[model samples]
Target: MKKRSSVLTLFLSVIMMLSLLSACAGNGNNAPDATNSGNKGSSNSGSELKKDTITALLPPVSANYQARFTDMEKEFNALYPHLTLKIEPASWEDMTQKLDTQVNAGSPPDIAWVGSTGISKYAALNVLIDLNAALSDEVKADYDEVAMKYFQLGNSQYGLPAYLAIHSIGGNKQFLEKAGIDWKNVQQNGWTYDQFRDAISKGVVKNDKGETTQYGFVFATSGVTSKDYLGIMAKSAGLPDYFDKNLKFSYTSKNFLGLLEAIRQMIDDGSMPKELSSIDAGKRWNMFLTGQTMITGKGLASFENSARLNNEKIKANDGSAVADSIEAEYIALPTPTFNGADYIPTAVVDGYIALRGKKDPSEEHIKNIGLAINFLSSGSIAANYSNELFLSPITESARNAAVLEQYPRNEENVKADQIMMSKAVPARTDIPTDLAAEALKIETEVIVPKLQALLANEISPQKMYDAVKAAAIKSFGEDGIVVD
Candidate 1:
């Protein structure tokens, strides 16, 4: 999936909450029970392997990356015969709808991927398999810690981190140099909302008549989180997730209102324009690529694509010409946070789960499942994935050691992605669905809007925040979706 500059898309990736944990540490809410009776029918533990078909589900496909995943399925089938795994593709566009349809139809895949955002709903509806009893500890350690927290109830495991998709800032370097902006300082100091606004405000260019020649910010909505960018900010701000003690949800909050007020402030300062509000990610991206904009927050793929398009050294495996050809030097940098919160790197983990059921839990079954995941998580898999499509590996070891040597991207012959991990607001796994969405809603609708109003000289950010908190509580209590 292409990472959008908007914040809601970040949560959309987490909609499944795979490879996740609660933002709150060791709340004792998601650890599995010792008895762990979820994996039933463990009769087949012999050396002779048995054959069972397992289905895996993955997130939406990008047109650029579709062929890459197809090659993965082919390789998996070629290597493993005793355990046949089928992959079903679902785009982020209608993920929750399709997932709900599958559950209603009683045709759940044995092991599948989902969004952290919707994990609470699935857990509430009892639609997943508990893998705590099945997986060994050694295998568990390879997972992203936040992803581990994403797949539990009171306590138990549901999924592993297949691949992670994270976010950062992307911009046209030519424009940056023209604007006299220093990306190095921005990266080192970790730009806050105020700093982000100041950068954009000075960078936005206008003609003598005050006619705008360039915009500083743009939006990338994808199919999820159409207009909300607060989801992206909340994770970075060290803000608590929306779930309450009972895990109920609401749509307004003081923190979120404060954030919105901040963004609106940017608008008032002539940093981010209101004209870019519509849900046209492609247009916004194209604008940025063409140097019509100076900055926008997005994921690695866009930065890679942007960089690859500009570098004469970059080319496809087939010796074919690349699209969107241009000479732009840009890198994906850590997105800004409010105040001084640390960076919280998050991604949509394409996870799989084996449900507790009538089927025999034979040794072959466990072995097969383990092997499938191993292959998927292996360096070879990353190689195939990177070659076929521009994908980053899930493991630090693979990303750091093998990938750069195996297949380098861009001119620097830069090896695989070294996703600089930080201890930001840790992921929240135990939280319920309604609570998460509702809480996110408050950030976008209630908080950000007020911030925008403040920027427009409508109200003070502090006042907007104070007033919105009471309203947020009311919405969550009366209108927000409540789960758990």
Candidate 2:
């Protein structure tokens, strides 16, 4: 009986051992499957990979600007499947206002395409990220020194320079030929201020009844274009830097006064449109487009548009070619020289600025933003952007590509790029913060109104100078200005 009982106990123990082994095997299989599941769902041990979305604000450059960005977004997304971009378009004025509002509300876009003029202002406000530390040396080397300097404040780079715009007098070839001026020669050897004045005088047309039908030049004296035109004229008059080295307004300088006098003379001679001060920018552009103006300052984009419109056969309501289709061939002339020195007009560098968030962004987020900027500012992208917009490229590779791809098709683009690269000086960078603010105040409150008066023949150059100087002295302190 004892032998039988001992055998039964041994059998039960064997069954229990098997059950323990089976349970251990089950746990081992389940543990790895659970761990693999967790690993598959996460990038790191503690957290899942967070998806990121970046917002970009841009001012409209052309009708197809948004579409181009849309394509770019797709390309960017292909490489970074976890990242997304939302592009928002706005007008220049609206963009500025919206940015201001966004900053105040602590909800600015991650990136923005801002005007070069505003770079300094934004940098001063400490709203932009210092790209000097963020961008790689290889990427920085791709940009032009002048372009890089345009948006630099101290050691910090506030923006990535993108499109460049070199303005030159675009002339109607028919009117220029009638004036006994070869546009090609003028482009090769730039015109003197006197020669420019003479061309304008000769280019003007009148009816048999002495009714003026076409003017030599037309431009609005307000808005961003006016600032560009005025700055170009100031530079051409041998004052490449609008402010003296000491950061004082050079409004009272002889060269600046000469520029004003030349404009007054043009207005008096009917070579320039008289109602320029009152005309809207659209009207001014239309006047140039319709062949009512012979020569006017324009960027490559506008020049191309004018050239296309001039070449296009106008159709009537019935789709028949109108007999009076504007027979004009518009060509770019070298910027006119004043003191025997042709100072090529440096273009306004519109570019992207990465903004500092209200709270510090993650390392990955910062890296992604930098990558986006680098992609946008790449040689190929720069080439394509400038090519499509008819603007000058800011990168050397883009410039070379432009010379090859754009020159054969549109020589004007290449010419503009060459002028910007070789002849254009960097935009003013020495303006002190206090001096800039005062100068801006003087410009809007005092100078613009006085300039309008001078253009209207309501004020003399001396009176304009006196008023501008007095305002500057009052704002910047008497010692700030160089009294001649």
Candidate 3:
């Protein structure tokens, strides 16, 4: 009996070995080819996948902006060899117009970097892909909550935040020290509106003949610049939210009036130059760089980049004696608060949105677009892009990267970013998705002119409020204004 059992076991082992050999032989024919895997648009099975050409429209904000996009292309292509990325460079205005035209013509780009204000507008138009249904939960969780909030409409997400632009009062140290204002201390503990008013007033430079040579603060009082400033001032002063719980225009509070009055007072006191009302954004920034203004409200990225450029120029001329050379050292000052409120810098989280083009794309195309968006919005890419552009990262992992710790200016900017993220009021908080275009129209057509008038002292704060209220009513009707 023992000899018979041993023979049966040996026969079973032989059968198992033969089955394994047969399975291995079958897998050999079905295995993916290794030699052709490196070829573009070729899969491991040696078959060609459908090649997707993705056009990306980006606003050029930095000198090396094109190089940055090129690097992104390489990075993305390394992971997605079948996808071809084409970048189209355009100025901000041109990009906006072109995108609008493309969307209207049903030929939109696959991806676009748009402003915070445009996200809701695009989402409302149903031009943007709903990321909530596209991205995985883990991918969605990678972004900072506050940053993601800016790109959301109701329960749907229209885009992923790419970078955060934190607005602060940047001052030249030489100018601040000459005016007996310690900018370092100001950085540690932000000043109140009253203190800011007095400091800027004293910082105004005059010639020997008592003619004004330089103003204290310079800002462009046109387009979105003036609107952002007014919103920040009014909101930081504890005014009612621009839109109430009902998503209506609620800018008729005393805080709104106070904001306008403050701007008028600054203009009357010679703190803010009246000429700013007509100057464009570029000229306004140049005014600050050329020492025509001591302080200005701008994104920290711009100030940091400007300082770096100036330093590079100075280094290039080392040991060459040049008199009257400008010594430019700029530092970010905390946005001044009002009525003891926390310093809430005017913050905007600009990001990229994926769009479904005029032709209904295949599911494979939609999946590829989602993958591209995820790659662009990843923490590593965000860190690299923000570090290169001198902007703040929108993801927590990117914010805490070791690269940010290496530069003192970046560290300072990161601290400012934290403050802005912690205590920010979205530039357009409660404007409903349906009313986004109307809100922007009212802002440009009605609000900007009134703000300019208020700053120029051509109109009273009450009159400005009345005009804004009337416009709001005309646009949204009385039902749109939330009554407390």
Best by TM-score: 3
lDDT by residue (tens digit), candidate 1, 1-484: 3545556777767865653543443353322221211111223221223456766666633433344567666665555434466777777666557666777777765665565555555655565556665565655655556656655555766655555555556667677767777765555555777677777777788999997777776555433544335556665655445553455442243445556566566666676666544435566666665566777755554366545544643344333323443456665556678645566544544544544333445544555555555455544544444433355555443454343223345532122133334333445655644555455556556665654455446776567756665655576544443321
Tens-digit per-residue lDDT, 1-484, candidate 2: 9999999999999999999987875552421111111002112322123467878888766545666778778766654556677788888657888887887787888889887777666665667777655566766777778888877766777767887667666777778888898777676657788988888889889999997889987666655555655666777786676478877667766667777777788889998877777765656666666778887665454566545644554532343433334655567776677756566664667788888757876655665566676666655567766766666567766765532233223475456446545677766766765566567667768777788888778999888878877887787677776565
Candidate that beats the other on TM-score, 1 or 2, i.e. the better one? 2
Candidates in descending lDDT order: 3, 2, 1
What TM-score, over all chains together, does every model reach?
0.69, 0.80, 0.81
Q: List runs of model 2 lying over 4 Å from the truth.
A: 1-49, 313-325, 339-342, 357-364, 396-421
Residue-by-residue lDDT tens digits, candidate 3, 126-166: 78876565566656676777778878776777777887776
Cα RMSD to the true fold for all candidates: 16.2, 9.4, 8.0
Give lDDT: candidate 2, residue 183. Answer: 73
Question: Using alpha carbons, what is the TM-score of model 1?
Answer: 0.69
Worst 10 residues of 1 by lDDT: 32-41
Q: Rank the candidate models, highest TM-score first.
A: 3, 2, 1
lDDT of 3 at 151: 80
**Model 3 / residue 158 / CA error / Å:** 1.3
